[model samples]
Target: MKGRATGGLIVALLTLMLAACTVVDLDADGKPIMPKDPNAKPGYSNQTPQQIAESGWASRVQQPAEQQALSWADMETKSHTVKAGASESVFVRAGGVVTAFDNSNARERHLTMTINGKPVQVQIGPVLRSNAIRDAAGFRFDEFTNQVQYAQLTKALNRHAVKQLPAVDASWVGKPVQALLAVTMAPGKVDDVVAIQLQQGSP
Candidate 1:
């Protein structure tokens, strides 16, 4: 019986050796190995979770405030010096607290104005207004005060009107008109206003 048992053990050992020697395409545990899933989403084996979230949010957020708006108004006005041969250059302190230094001709009026303490300048190009108002105490007066501010402000307004106006209107393009630039300096506020009239000459 011992010889029979020894024979049985030898058979079992031989079977195991044969299994190990076999070149089947199986894993170390002798289970069939499968191919990787092609549709599986890729993962970062390198980056931690926190780094991914922060990087994503940073890209979507707005930039800092300095790059956002146009330059500060008060700081912007100080840079410009009045140009040569302005049609009128007399300093007129008029209508309570409004100050006007105007240079004008038949073609246009360029104005330098200081209202309250703010400075603005403007060129009244050949555009006609049926009836324009220039006030002593208002935002419009501020536009007349500073040349740079008034030019920028009027350019914006005129551009808006030009866009809406009909293209075929020839009179709207190059018609000479009366232009008035005024400055108002009130308590705690400075302003300039430019008034244009088409029917009359420069004002």
Candidate 2:
């Protein structure tokens, strides 16, 4: 009888351990329980990094939603060193990664570009569209996102294609920027772009 009792205790302990692992502490309605991260706070997504306490993953970590739409329109950009007769590139910083966006997308938002002190308006494209979430490994197939097929996935994800640039600058002539970047949650709206960044190099 003592041996049987010991076995039962062990089983109970094992069950408790398993329960702990499965406990996600979701809200009453099964939504993810948002933490105290300032970024997750209500209306934080629309605020700029400087305007708010912090931005990027730090904000997302505390937010209730697993995904957030980031936008940057009418963002004032810095000068870039573009090479003669080469493709100029710009980066969009999101979730800690500085990824290139399609030129068509940039043009749609009327993103301002300055090359060698000359302002130019251009669209951008993503050099790396999709990224694998480090923690999303080996979950079910539904959770898997193969970044390799980013082109097709992004094409489906972005509803509207390049439409129109409300503003355009012709000063970018004869100048090339090594790098440029911007971010936004709203598109086609006349608003200051958020989280603008740039780099200079030959590509």
Candidate 3:
């Protein structure tokens, strides 16, 4: 009876061991492995520029207050130097026309204007980045060189009928327009304009 009981006990232990071996899955190093879902889709990490633009991802990205403050501070500091060009302030109001709008470089749109009786080339962008002034000011990309808008602006400028006009217009090509200009200080050199506003009134 004792020997029969011992054989039965050994069989029960073997069964438990077999069950454990079947149930417990382990890696080669003895760590338990996580079961992966077969229906999961693969992730895409690389996105093209067009894809990014279409996604409007940049507008969703938020900058921390501290970072934004710093950016504004830096912008102010740079603007101050330009602003100092004014005898009492950094902003000078002047009238001008779009003497030339060169879009030769798709990324950087160069606008040459006759301001204060001098030809000033204004650099509009490296449009790929958010730091572009034109983008910041809400100017449409095509408005810079749209032919219809250009013709209208030129006609208005030629008429010289409007004494006070808005600083910016979709149709202000050849018109006498005013803008607040930020001048850069350089020794023995004509100051470059850092910023401009197409004004619609006498300053």
In terms of TM-score, the best-performing candidate is 3
TM-score ranking, high to low: 3, 2, 1
- What TM-score against the true fold does each predicted structure earn? 0.18, 0.21, 0.32
Summarize candidate 1's per-residue lDDT along 116-156 as a digit string, tens digits.
34444433433422111112111232324355443343334
What overall lDDT goes with each candidate model?
Answer: 0.33, 0.31, 0.41
**Candidate 2 wrongly placed segments (more than 4 Å):** 1-114, 117-119, 124-144, 147-203
Which parts of model 1 have CA positions greater than 4 angstroms off? 1-97, 101-103, 116-119, 127-203
- Rank ordering of all candidates by lDDT, starting from the highest: 3, 1, 2
Candidate 2, 88-142: lDDT as tens digits: 2222332222222324544243334443343433333222232111111111223
Model 2 scores worst on lDDT over the 10 consecutive residues at: 130-139
Cα lDDT for residue 114, candidate 1? 39
The sequence of per-residue lDDT tens digits that candidate 3 reaches over residues 34-72 is: 666698543222433233323422231111111222222
TM-score between model 2 and native? 0.21
What does each candidate score in C-alpha RMSD? 22.8, 15.2, 16.2
Residue 201 CA error for candidate 3 (Å)? 7.8
